[model samples]
Target: MKDRAIERDMDWLVQVFNWAVRFRDDSGRYLLSENPLRGFDIPAELNPRRPIVPRDWMEKVIEAAGPTPLRAMLVIADETGRRLSAIRQLQGSDIQLGRTDAWPHGAIRWRYHSDKVNKDWLVPMSTKLRTEVDRHLAANPVLGDAPLFPAPQNHRKSVSKDRAGAWLLTAIKRAGVQKLDGTLWHAIRRLWITEHKEMPLRERMYVAGYLNRQTMEMVYEHIDPLLLQETVETRREYREAR
Candidate 1:
């Protein structure tokens, strides 16, 4: 069985077993122990794959999206390195356009509430991204509590993840980029994380809303060969100077 399928089964088993334990004649004697199947390893080939969308491809996708809200979403995802779900849940109130004492380039106070972690985190947006967001907000004024990317059918609600993914797919098609099967939206996030090797690990983790270095390195970080080479050269130069 697939890792996810196994996980689902294990979860269901736990629930059923716990329910039985709670209602049994000898409940104290029927306690469910730790799940033996909790850490089943997924085969590398079966893992959900995310293609690395290069900076040029990202530009093309944005260009294809034009001045639409989708374009803003794409830019924000790339700049913030946030998960698609978190990006979709963004509210107008979360955005702070003008420069702040803490964030000279301006920042977005993103609230991510999920099973992994639930907290409000701030991340600085690039000048270009901030300008784009400002233009978008100016063109389409919304209430502070309204969704940043409001649903077309309902302005009060945020756009569904499926709808956002469809918009990204359309942009990818229009841009003539290779279709990356299951990697369209998420690959952008991966690209964003991968490109920030210059940033300190702790700072990167905080900015990316990651709980630890292990998860960041194992799942998110995709070291670029060119970047690695550049770093190696810099080290060599420093050593020669000494």
Candidate 2:
């Protein structure tokens, strides 16, 4: 496995050990004496910067995707900026259409268990997103707890992560977009974040299901200096000096 892949495995194992150490039986005795790997030093991961997908490239790919489940996944990724894991496992129950107190238009409830952050996010759906989702759900027609995108072989389970990635690659090829390094499903997410950089930091973080501000600003956002310069030019001080 690659270094980052191995690091992720070690992290998951450590979490397992921590859970086991905390588990108790009916007798109130600890299930495990201690986390064996509790004090183990995990090397810092050297992750490469992920490039943001251009809007035109993404649109081309989405258009080329046809009516497959991948098309919906791409739209969700572009609109919500949430992880692919959450998108793949989306259920009919997760969607609440029509006006709500929280969301006047509608909302998509991202369940805690399905995400890495372990936080439930009620994200308001954009008009474009709602239209696409409505079209998909109308055709697909899933009831409560039924996965929006079920596995072809087994309808009981959602499509595997590998399968989803493969579908995306296929779409990219059909669109004739040069698949650059680090431009994966997550790249579209970065694009979403970059496009919404004008929003208040905390509010953006909440919408994006981010727990840490640093992670959102440092990892997910790709700052465009030209865009920043244009925004700065609009400031009172710059205008007054002209």
Candidate 3:
């Protein structure tokens, strides 16, 4: 397992051990005499940096994903920069196709109940995203409360995150795309965030549903030094004119 994964599991196990220590039976005796794993030192986690998914890699994966629902998920991730947990739980009701004064191209309404931050967000969709969503809806035809991407064996539940990742991995293998550790889904999200670096910080935060500015700036967004230099050079004249 990756260092971060190991660290996370160890932390969770420590919590479990603590809970077991406090657990009492009907006789009011503790279930565990003591937390056996107490004072066990977890290893310091290594840096968990991941590269952004290249546009070519994404194009190849999307093309090779074929008729599967994973294609739609990939497109959404690339376009919206939403987390896999949020994307997988998407329902037909969450999308608003009709144009509004605020959202000319329609919008997506992410609910607080299902969001990782437990906050509601309503953001407008791009024309490309709207078209893709419309096409997916036509093909899958899910209604209110039903998951857009339901499990093949069990329609009652949304497709598991692991299963979705596996599907993406399979597509990656088929497309002959390589490099980086795991979770190409998040890599795609990183690409989306990085691409919007020129946007206002607050607007980008709102669109990406990011509460912590540090994580959004430091983790998700990968700034290109050369690009920044070029941007500054290009805008030098405008700055001088003012």
Candidate 4:
């Protein structure tokens, strides 16, 4: 079979074999002992794809977005460290600009069932990010419990869900942040995860919305050169003082 494989038409072969056994088998229930190749995965490289741009470039993209929906979308990335699902799930009413916590930072509260990860976690709203959201909401206004940015003015639909990709990609191009990594949105998550890795395990977990320490460590941990060097140098200085 291997020797004549290229000439034999692998695609048609599998299709015909499946049809014959599934439909024509006498019992229709008889099964082979195993199908060893059933679980095989396609190589990622064999599939064509682009990648994420760096965070600095992403920031530049948001700047280029100017007063457009593009800027609001990017600012949400900075504020919530939210998944795109979480972002889309927001209603203009959900942003709590009026809430002032005793905590140093401001706050954002949305519903528990709003996104894929069904937990309700409140993210700290840094002053800078808070200002950004207030401004975005002010400019965009509320058409409904729909997308913050609908299609371009000429297009006819108000967004029902998951429109971050289209607008964000346009923003990226406009900003000229063109080098691509495999998952662009993920790079935003990566930015948040990397930024907070050094916080105590419990604290980082709470901020990133992990239910507990172990899951947070397992999923979000990444080594940072500056942090590692700071730890090592601090230890050496302490030892010298002793």
User: Largest TM-score belongs to which candidate?
Assistant: 2
Candidate 4 local lDDT, 112-179, one digit each (tens): 77655577776677777777877887877764455555556523344433456767777777777674
Task: Note the residue pairs that clash in candidate 1.
Answer: none
Put down candidate 3 lDDT per residue, 1-242, tens digits, no spaces: 76778888988988898888899989998878887877887875566667788779889999899867998898888888888888888887888889988888898887787767999999899888887888888889988888988998998788998899889889989999895566677788898899898899898888878888998887788877789898788853445544
Candidate 2: tens digits of C-alpha lDDT, residues 1-242:
56666777899999888888898889988888898887888765687557889999999999999988899889888888989999999998998887877777688999998888999888898888888888898878889999989988987799999999899899999999989776497788899899999898887887778998888888889988889799888865545554
Q: Which stretches of candidate 2 lie over 4 Å from their true place?
A: 1-42, 45-47, 100-104, 228-242
- Which runs in model 1 stand beyond 4 Å of their true positions? 1-48, 114-116, 228-242
Which is superior by TM-score, 2 or 3?
2
Candidates in order: C-alpha RMSD to true structure: 4.6, 4.1, 4.6, 8.5
- Candidate 4: the clashing residue pairs are 51-180, 51-181, 51-182, 52-181
Query: Which structure among the candidates has the greatest lDDT?
Result: 2
- Lowest-sum lDDT 10-residue window in model 3: 233-242
Candidate achieving higher TM-score, 3 or 4: 3
For each candidate, give its TM-score against the true structure: 0.79, 0.81, 0.79, 0.64
Q: Please give the CA lDDT of all the candidate structures.
A: 0.78, 0.87, 0.84, 0.61
Which ranges in model 4 have alpha carbons more than 4 Å from their true place? 1-53, 101-106, 143-162, 212-215, 230-242
Instruction: Evaluate model 4: give its TM-score.
Output: 0.64
Alpha carbon RMSD to native, model 3 = 4.6
Shift of residue 181 alpha carbon in model 3, Å: 1.1
